[model samples]
Target: MNLVNMQRKHSSYLLAFFTSVALMSVGTARDLRDVTEPKIPPSCTTLKASGGDDTETIQKALDSCTKGKAVALSPGVFHSGPLNIPSGVGLVVDTGVTLKAITDPALYDLGAKTCGTVDDVGVGCKAFITMLRVTGSGLYGKGTIDGQGNVTLIGQKKSWWDLSEEALVAGTFQNVPRLIQINNSADITMYQLTLIDSPFYFVTSIETNGFTAWGLTIIAPASARNTDGIDPIGSQNVTIAHCNIRTGDDSVAIKAMTAPSRHISVLNSHFGHGNGMSIGSEVNYGASDVLVSGLTLNGSLKGAHIKSNTYRGGHVVNITYNNVCIVDVKNPIYLEMDYVHLHGNRTPEFRNIAFNNIRVLSTGIFILQGLSDSNPVVVSFNDVHITKGSRWSRHFANVTGTWEEDASGHCGYAGNE
Candidate 1:
């Protein structure tokens, strides 16, 4: 069989059939790059405009939509102060509309810019812009995005002390109000929305990417200082399902910078009080593969919180908290590394954490602190159930390492039946 080796084996089978048809056309253009779900537009109605006019007639029918349509908003109460969605159009709000937020907080200021320096401060300088300001890439929210102010500031009175350093050098904040600010967006989807009362940080996703907040009903007022209901900053592939967060701070916060938040998923949620399911107070630059499953904390303060801060070092490895259900939580398993004012103590590494099937009814103080020397955040506990709240008992203070209870007899970490 030597005809010049059969013409080099038929030119290597035609170069493996044109490299398998160019890798199946790049996997069909990455599955058509998802995010194409918003077509409910039948002229879209009910926009009355009366907080001193200028509603722009529902912003000219959402600027005459075309790309992936959607501009439905029917059920009353729309003073229209912010509403700016124009980039692949989408502003659906069918289930009882209600887009209020114009008590004159400078018409939901998007001028943003509280000072400058430090590399020019991006993320729109913590944008305190209210109502709704979708900056493109498929934004869709189904009804009720109300942010009427006073989400509690405890006794109020300090309007920047009636301004005057030239109105505080004119960087803005003459009133303060932040309800929905999705900056640098990419495929955002909010379903069954009911976001209420905000003066700061209600639903903010800076530097976004493929976010989905499902069945939401975030209400702030337990003294809403920082507000924080759903803040997926520096995000990527996030999905917070069936939400009902009652916040004053931290309902679902997974910040980034050091990169630690890749495909995040929080299922069937219902958090009370606040400061509950958090990942990092802003992981200097790291946070990877997170998943907080089926949560339901009734009276939370700290249930499944993993904070880090030593001048923001980084590293909070693959986290997973499955099927959680705490009643009177005070601190049902929190892991802190330092968290105060971060500087650079270095030591920030929490590897593959997992807490499966948790069910608590308590004032248990289970804190696992780790900092000096580093390594000690790899936790795994299957089927955790703690009960005994007449003051607090279950304690595991200053844990440095090794609490591996996974032989599957369904964990019962000694006592407190």
Candidate 2:
């Protein structure tokens, strides 16, 4: 349908559904980017990279670092294995330094002979940087953390990305390490960090509260598999702002795997060559109360997506996207319920999603699919302008509100930081 000032025919039904309800009140609004950036703490200790393995030196500094202080890595190339960050401490990679992860699978094996191999259960490798059960801990720097996904393994001919492709063909999973893993931790921060070429997901947090990712630059090749930028899983009160992410998978994926993920905000971010902002294929618990504002997607595979199948499905509500711009994106607005054709008993719900002041500069396929006719996706639009030749494929959706083809306004889109 030509989305020109379109109004829902069943407006009365929606009005009755929300007559006494406030949609924005569905989840808490604890945006971490609402405050100013904190000053970098003074360094408790600084260590120059030895010409050999620096994992022991770095780990020792972090383990002995004082609370409310950071351990600084001097400006040099440092090769290391897995490193842990203690609670109430920080790690800093100073400018002109590149901390590269060693490609030895044995160093990352979790006592399961699954690292550097393919299997059905792929969670077998530990992250390069682990923050477990920590509070007030962070990674701050202007330098880079290079996972070296393209580098060949110590004893294998294939690199990390090559193994990922092989696993896809073999119908299994590649046991590769993630760059950063934050688990069971609270009040964590990642500031001004440049992450590149992760073997798996770049940064992931699970069951943690009060998380923030600000001024992050993440990049990966388009062919790299499973390289998600930042994923907040089963976490609440989170914010990701001023990020420029280009990855193989979702730039920012909000998931509810272990618990309900709620009260999150993603503001003023730019995406390129990735599956843009997304809300899970693992939302089995629920995900609610998310606000994404002042965003841009350029040359992306998908933009503003929500994908979930019956096996990993649950309630997704009270999401808002405001002041967004898209250019040369393929699937502009994709919301699917039968993702990957996974089938089960859990029903998926998408409700009260709002898009305001959006502009798409290129024509692309737009999809909004729900599970069934009885469980249609509920969404609204206001001042959303797309290119004239765009095509829409909608199924089992109650698309309401207004849209236009006059894409003249800029939507206040500033590219990236």
Candidate 3:
């Protein structure tokens, strides 16, 4: 009634609060487009294990599944132990289903005593044939998970006088157990699986969400020491596509701890040998919108790796590597921001990295740098092509950033190409 009726009732309550925030952002994008592909039910239950040395107890047939149950395994060799797939469990392994993992590490600690030892590394209590350990939210597995023994890491061959008696001999080295461990699960989907010879770290997705491993075939033993195929730790919207990784270590490693890592995409993969396609030694807690495209590294020691650890500080932004195909790799495009064997507290900045159209056949040495100099990490190698294979040459030690080498020179700084 005064001052023009109180400014017309405060502009009609700010136009009804912006029309309820644009109708709640179109109802949250129509509930994420109605949950984009998550509904694989039809196959109620059938847990059968006849031969591959059947001792079948697979965590009592996955605790006799109830929530959207589907445990159909019948093609033998399921010594069964350490399979906790409760919460909408749907484990199916049809074509010659073999879920072996009973090399008998004392049958779940008879007197093994929960063995523990780290760093000096003599740890044992060995009963981790994980094969499936999902925590709720629609877990799905499809076939052939063979984590049979021979995964040795007991102090990693204790030299130096048996490493202080294997670090005071508690359990003396036994960490071999990780076929499929998805803790804190959410909308997990594994398709056409065949993880073989997994002594450790075949597929481990910790703190998950909408994770996907498609057309998988992770094989161990390029020298199968610490087999790492698919490890998405502290995850988010992850998608590891068309996989066929031959592992000894680091076939796919994308990790972040206290959130920041977002939208990971590894496409058309066929990484070879091992220790390739990595992001962070575990970037304390910082990563964003990573996209690694169409990789096919054949015989790798290092290809497309971005490690950080001068002392545990983190920041990797908008990483994008496109159309990579490095054959006979040894330091084929690596960016180590003072990895220093990954200890802690290191990060000035590893900003907005982008490597496009890389095709190197260098048997050894093609741009390996340790960035430092007051926080300098802005790599941009566009259309890189290195083919010098006489025995290594191209090198860049402690990088300071800004190398716009494109006209093929293949990358040179140690006396300029």
Candidate 4:
């Protein structure tokens, strides 16, 4: 070959080698970019707050958030009244940011706007954060939400907990607002947040779908009355996972107050010093396709508790329990049909319940009860073993089901049995 032709071929080979190397480097850079990109949307807010009753500014920020951008609470204390969260908005509460709820009752319950049956108890609608019919929204940050539940309202020396306890004596729940209340929302995500000391439930969701709560730390004193951690009322396809909850009431209570709650899951959580992982205090409708798995509970009152009565008209079906470990709990598995003020004719039914792979070290276990007219039927216990030091017995009234060994235990009877 000629020298010029050979030189041209050599230049071509060098260019090809360099081009291949550049292509490989470009591919590696693309992979690194993909790895660094966030799975969730980023919080890019231009709004910054200075101080003192930043409700209007924060609400304006939230209102201005778009699909790609988010509203961020900068690292400081922000006092706010009721704030509404709309659809397609993202809120990021940064670390060291404390959102404090104002204690004035007038801003929330003004003009006689009431929550569910609040008029019967002379209370009105109120909350710290309200999300109604929101979709595709995300709230993820490491911050604190102070409900200020212990503060006394105007002209009332009693705290909210004391007021709630007194109201319970008269069978009324009034004059208290939840920390976060969302209704009919979908695709909502809340993570890595610390919600503390709410006068009512930490988060109350009704008629929501595709909601997820994860990596949440919910805490209140044991004397904080009726302070549930996460309540999903009539919500569908909701998931509560990886939460550390220590509250006064149920750590996670799935209720059926508005509609039927279906496909609810509580997984991989730690519950302490609370009512452990309950189904309902009010199952007025239906709750089905529920699954509770991989829960480690300590110092809680009850585990796998289902409370209803003859008056609450509905059924709990297709509930499954797996891999729950309980220690120092009062009653590990309690299913009762004896809620108070049950005067209605329609009886609640608990059917098709299955318990498997539960290990309990508790004071007692198995309160397996049902109503006389509508007995709890088709409950099967598989591989459930309990070691109770005090009151190691099962209190069975109208519960009729089957159990497999090593389930040799004593069962006490009620008067009808």
Which one is best on lDDT?
2
lDDT of each: 0.60, 0.87, 0.60, 0.72
Candidate 2 clashes between residue pairs 3 or more apart in a chain or in different chains: none
What are the models' TM-scores?
Answer: 0.31, 0.94, 0.32, 0.81
The clash count for each model shown is 14, 0, 14, 0
* Tens digit per residue, CA lDDT, model 2, 114-218: 899889988889999999999999999999999999899988998989889999999999999999999999999999999999999999999999898989999
Worst 10 residues of 3 by lDDT: 26-35
Among the numbered candidates, top TM-score falls to 2
Q: Give me the runs in candidate 2 sitting further than 4 Å from their true place.
A: 1-34, 409-417
Q: What's the residue-level lDDT of 18 in candidate 1?
A: 34
Better of 2 and 4 by TM-score: 2
Per-residue error (Å), model 1, residue 371: 4.6
TM-score of 4: 0.81
Candidate 3's TM-score:
0.32
Quote the lDDT for 336 in model 2.
Answer: 93
Candidate 1: global Cα-lDDT? 0.60
Error of 2 at 383 (Å): 1.1
Higher-TM-score candidate among 2 and 3?
2
Identify the superior model by lDDT, candidate 2 or candidate 3: 2
Per-residue CA lDDT of model 3 for 1-417, tens digit only, reads 322233234444554553343234322211121223344555556666655444445556656767666667666556564555666666776577667665443443425443322343434433343323454433345567776635333334332223223433654444335667776667677776787877567787776766777778888777655578988876777777777888888998877765545677777777889898887766677766677767777786988887877665577766777667676677877776666665544553566566666666455554445454545655544445556442332223322112222223332211112
